[model samples]
Target chain A: MSQLLRQHIEKITPLTDSEFTYILSHFTPKKYKKHQFLVQEDAPVPNDFFVTKGLLKASYTNLNDGKEHILQFAWEDWWITDYQAYFNETASSLTIDCIEDVEVLCLSLHNREKICAELHKIEHFFRRKSNAGYVALQRRILSLLNSSAEERYHQLLVTYPQLFQRVPKTLIAAYLGVSRETLSRFSK
Target chain B: MSQLLRQHIEKITPLTDSEFTYILSHFTPKKYKKHQFLVQEDAPVPNDFFVTKGLLKASYTNLNDGKEHILQFAWEDWWITDYQAYFNETASSLTIDCIEDVEVLCLSLHNREKICAELHKIEHFFRRKSNAGYVALQRRILSLLNSSAEERYHQLLVTYPQLFQRVPKTLIAAYLGVSRETLSRFSK
Candidate 1:
């Protein structure tokens, strides 16, 4: 499990054994069964989780309709959080729940800032990751605005085909902001 | 203009005068007229622009209809670019144009990376900025998924009322992904 974390960090920059050891010390490992909530709406978000295994989703619920809007899915190697809540130290506006049995290394904001102040490379790694996430979100916005629902459905399939095999179609439809019938027609 | 840049960076981390001078040297100041293109689709994107004056917008156009979808609007103290193109050092997938006569400080990828590698605080500043950008984009995703066009219009007006005063209603309609007629009704 530590090796998975090391490899993930190493993808951004190679770290020496001692360096990785120190950074790893700041994180706490935790596991959850399928259908567990990592974060709940209105609760304080204390940590950001880096998934080592299993799948999870982050979503916001509309108070008026009580409809769930899927914001993102985090599988192996992905980071998931109510980032605004985590960074600002406020109540979460989103919920993150496990879709499969999950393992993650959780880092507190204090530890994250300490390590960033300590290691230049770690800061670089995080900055790059954040930039990549920003670009992906921008792409998603473009997809939502410019593409038809059918076009977006195909795009999502092409981008994360493995997701279809793991996630229920109903949830996938929610992620696409489409009716289940509409998604089924696209899938066909 | 440099003071605006310093103040922006200092919002995240303080910098000594010498350090701020060194960082400022990496950027080139330039100005553009309203209606000028800062970036054209398919052109190589070379720099990220930091707005010190006036306004600009970045957008992608749908191929079939040639309809523009505004990705972002940048005014004084804001940053704007084809980030995917700038970061990847590739041709732009979007166009950026001046919404008003604009003045900006442009930083190339090479210079950006060089400064980030050289100055730890600069790296910290960029990471913090990126994280904030990521969270903002996430909010937009939730809004896009959950809000009706009327709700979105009101939210936009409330959040950035200055945008309405500075930009044309037709462009605001484009930004909201609403028809001009629909936007007219909302404005009424």
Candidate 2:
């Protein structure tokens, strides 16, 4: 199990076996049943979870309309969290719920700090991942600003075809910033 | 001048004078006049600029409409780049333009890699910055999904009040995902 994670980390930086084991010691393996809430809105986010199996959705409820807008979906190898609350140690305005039965490696904020102090290269690994995340967010913002609903849907299909299949269309529609009816029409 | 950057780096990680000097040596200073382009759309992005003085905007032009959307604004102490292209070494789809006369410390991808290799703590500094950026991006995504235009504008005002004075209203409106007219109407 640690070998899988070590391989992932090795893709970015070469980590010695001992270093990989040292980093792995900080993570706690956790499992969630389908539809279970991993993190709740308005609650403190203390950890970030890396999915080993199954799917998860990060979403926020619209107060005005009482509708949930999916912000992101994570499958195997993806990290899921309420990043704002996690990093700031503040109450989260978002919720992460299991879309399918899930097994995840959870790392606490405290443990993360320890890893940074103990293994320096781990920080570089996380930094590269964060840089990639920043780019992804920038792309999403541009898409929302300029792309049509159909175009956005098409982009999602092209970029994350697996996610389209794993998640329900309604959730995918919300993530794409479109109505379910619109996604249905566009799909046809 | 370097003292200010040293202070910024110290905020995240403690670095000795020699280490700071070594890191500074990797940066090349550059200047840009107002309205000048730092990077152009569909061009290779080789460097990331750290603002020392003045303001800049990074934007993407919609190919279909020829309209541009501002992705972000950089003032003193802020970093600006088409990160996607910078990291992947691909042609950038975005352009970075100076909104006000600016001075920046430029670091090319090659030198950045060299710094990471030589100074391990520098990697930590960048990782922490990237983590903060990721957190901010997550918040921006939530703002777009859950907040009204007025709410987003208000949040932006609270977070970056100085930006209103530094950047034009049209770009600010675009950053908040609202039309310039809508922002003007809301302000009144």
For every model in order, what is the iRMS?
Answer: 0.5, 1.2
lDDT of 2 by residue, A1-188 (tens): 55667877898889887888789999999989999999998899999998889999999998878889888899888899998889889999888999899999999999997887677687778878888899898888888878887998999899888987788888988897788998899989
Q: For residues B84-188, could you state the per-residue lDDT of candidate 2 as single tens digits?
A: 999999999889998889999999999987897677788888888988988888778778877889988888889888887777888888787678899998789
All candidates' TM-scores? 0.99, 0.96
Which 10 consecutive residues of model 2 chain B have the lowest summed lDDT?
A: B60-69
lDDT of 1 at B110: 97
Ten contiguous residues with the weakest lDDT in model 1 chain A = A60-69
Candidate 1: give the TM-score of chain A: 0.98
Cα RMSDs of all predictions? 0.7, 1.4
Give DockQ per model, in order: 0.94, 0.79
Assess candidate 2 and give its TM-score to the true structure: 0.96
Once superposed on the true structure, which residue ranges of model 1 sit more than 4 Å away at CA?
Answer: none
DockQ of 1: 0.94
List model 1 lDDT by residue over A39-97, tens digit each. Answer: 99999999999999999999988999888899999999899999999999999999999
The digit string of per-residue lDDT tens for model 1 on B106-156 reads 999999999999999999999999999999999998999999888999999
